[model samples]
Target: METTDFSQPIRQSAKGIIVIFAFNLVTFVKKFFVLFIAFGVSILRSKSIGNVTPTMMVLAVIGVLLIILIIAILKYLNFKFYLSKDDFHLATGIINKDNTIIPKSKIQNVYIKQNFLQQIINVVSVKIETAGDKKSEIEISALDKPTALLLKKKLFRKASSVSEELEQSESIEEPEVFFKVTPKRLLLEGLSQNHFKSFLLIFTFGFGLYSEFKDFLQELELEKHVEGLVELDEATILNLIITNVIILIGVVLISFLFSVVKTFIINFNLEVVEHQKTIEINKGLFNKVSLSLTPSRIQNLVITTNRVKQYFGLHTIAVKQAMVNVKQQKNFNIVALEKEQLDYLVNKLLSNYNDEQGDVAKPRPYFMRISALEMFLFGVVINGLSLAIFGIEMLWINAVFMPLAALYVYFAYKKAYYRISEDFVTIGSGVIDTTTNILEIHKIQSVKLKQTIFQRPRAIASLVISTASKSVTIPYISKSEAISIYNLLLYKVESQDRDWM
Candidate 1:
């Protein structure tokens, strides 16, 4: 594989760091304000709010200003960046210069962002990401857009070649026009689906109303100072309930509308293109993110089915890759599809492969029953503690909740289980909201077996399989079974001579 050095351009751009200093100045000012607020609040709560001494106030102000100025001066004096043959380097700081090197082979993606100001100035911001950190590998604030893109492409090519060697397989196929969520489907999904944002909005509105009513009641001191501000008659009670119900309905409707608008904007012009060796996803009206990933990078696949969707026999599949930086990785890389479409896509990603036998390991039925017992005990302890904290006012609630809690715990534990197959590992869990994760053998990085005191008596244990970026744990298994899986994984890693990452 061939690589290009980006050292000269990065170094040249780093000199005379006026802009860098200015950015740091703004950051320092923000931090200073935060500190000021915290200090002022602390002092005000303990003593007279308006009795702050002039000396103290002047000293605080001077301290904030000095800190900001010192940071700005350092930034102006010490910022620098350069490119190495296989990596890029950045050095900054006046007193103790910090050096960072990002290997080209680890580069996952590169991005260019330009706001209205950048468009006018003919300069762009460049962000390079690698599988090293959740933050950007390097951020170049101002650069000629064409030159930046050229450099990004050159690095991407080098990274892709190295990744190909690692996979040791021919390039994966990319479809010309892959499946996409259209405007109509997006709208339908939003209205029919129970999205996180929708529930959050509903919760917010309800909580706000409750808080305001509670505050107003406290201020009125109704029981202590009963006044006829608003007559508490039958008409008043009826009106209050009706108004609250109307508000709740409105909240639901508004939540649905917000979801629809968000879905429409995000999936607008959504497209996924597959190349011979990689897949590229492009979409979004604002703050767009373009992600490219090879099939071999995928660590696990999750298929989720909600109650309503389950009734319709529909499921949404999310493809998870082992990118070290979760934030820098792609969203919607896990596309929603019908069952057949989902199966087809999974097959394509997996491709034709030899079915190497997986090490045998199975949790016995008794282990699952024990898991249920543990869950029930946990619920009892938690509710018991809550009752002690809240007193008799909550005693009645706990009495009614006892059985329900036990049942829930029992179901939760009963649902938790795992199975190792010839080429993959499957874990199923959840009581009210069940989910099964399917992970390929090659995707696993490490396997751990653990035994608790109670589990030791029963010869039961737990297994945690770690991927490049995520971990899935099986709560209850036999100790012997856990050992078998761990040993197999150790053997595979050593034989391959490649880090799980």
Candidate 2:
């Protein structure tokens, strides 16, 4: 294909107009929900009170719909995207146009999504992301599946010959399946999820709903009935307690069901397929998302397991790549499975992965003393303030909590450790919830050694290793140890020939 022909601008699929319109409508409603609701109520009241006719309300609705449709059409007409040899270019806008040129080398990942509507129409939405961009640089709302796949392949490989090779390989060989989620394992993972967090979310949601209901009742001048319940006799208080218990049970059941359904939908039929140089993930129910990950671009690997998951011998692995913005980092989850399966997948995906638990170096012994002292000081300050304001009656509560706080800090200090290998560095932290972060030594972008005034006397410092996506800090290590690790990492990064991104 000639460069000029391939670089020519092309519009999105025709159905994209509808998709864009729906997306814009939803966005507008979300941003101005309160204004929209108030305006709608005013219009409805006008009609009800004979200030406005039904015909007028109908006309207003039609006008708003027509405006939204026109905006969507204009957006569709303005959007154009194409690929050059070195850069992917996108031009879009209604009034003030935006031209974005993303270098092919900087492209981190390409995501393809198909919602229920897109599935019915046989089209997909493609998102092109780069390292520094918080949002996808280029988003084709709707494109024919074949065209989208071709564009994706060409953009990633940056060569027409590679596309041809991929096509030929697909015809000749099947991709190796690395791991897949079984229904039983999926159920176990869902059941073992953090129920306390789910309960908190449910509680917050219930409170918000109650607040909205109270406002609605007040709007209708019916809040007096609710306030009357506050003047409670013994029978009324007993009845209230029973009623609250029943309501709480219902809420908990609903929240649990929601959590299960959400987990199932998100991880439904999750599969990992390994190609020659990359891995492909396909999953989800209503909105199916497919992502391609290159091993060379991975920054760190985090394997996490809570107490409940540990009990079931399950672990969740999160793969962090070269993301410029922390908020935009999409930690690709390959699978949540048993330790054996997790180790197998990790070894396969990362050739340098070590299954052996190597000897880890702990912080200095004084680290625990420092941690306990800090916790004790904090507890004393908090207890002193409470005593001055609330009264000495609450002294017993502080007496119970201070020791617990100190114990937690002691455990946290004990859990913190670092292990450095010839090729990789592993840092483990956290108390009740443990997380281990592993990063290839050569991929480190920078290193820093820090010391505070208190630590200066002890000759202890903190070492921070920064990669493209995130940083890992080992605190309260000996200054000499921190300097040695820093120099070693810098030397490794400088000596490597591989690209960090």
lDDT score for candidate 2 against the true structure? 0.79
In model 2, the Cα lDDT at residue 284 comes to: 80
Question: What's the true lDDT of residue 119 in model 2?
Answer: 80
Per-residue alpha-carbon lDDT of candidate 2 for residues 356-471, written as tens digits (9 for 90 to 100): 55568998877788778877898889789879967988788777887788777878887888998878888988766678888888788889998999889889999988888779
Error of 2 at 114 (Å): 2.4
Model 2, total clashes: 0
TM-score of predicted structure 1: 0.68
RMSD, every candidate, angstroms: 6.8, 5.4
The 0-to-1 C-alpha lDDT of every candidate, in the order given, reads 0.64, 0.79
lDDT of 1 by residue, 150-258 (tens): 6765666666665545344333332465666666655665565665567687777777887879877787666533554456577666877998899778877888888
Weakest 10 consecutive residues of candidate 1 by summed lDDT: 353-362
Error of 1 at 358 (Å): 8.3
For model 1, what is the alpha-carbon lDDT of residue 474? 76
Which candidate has the highest lDDT of all? Answer: 2
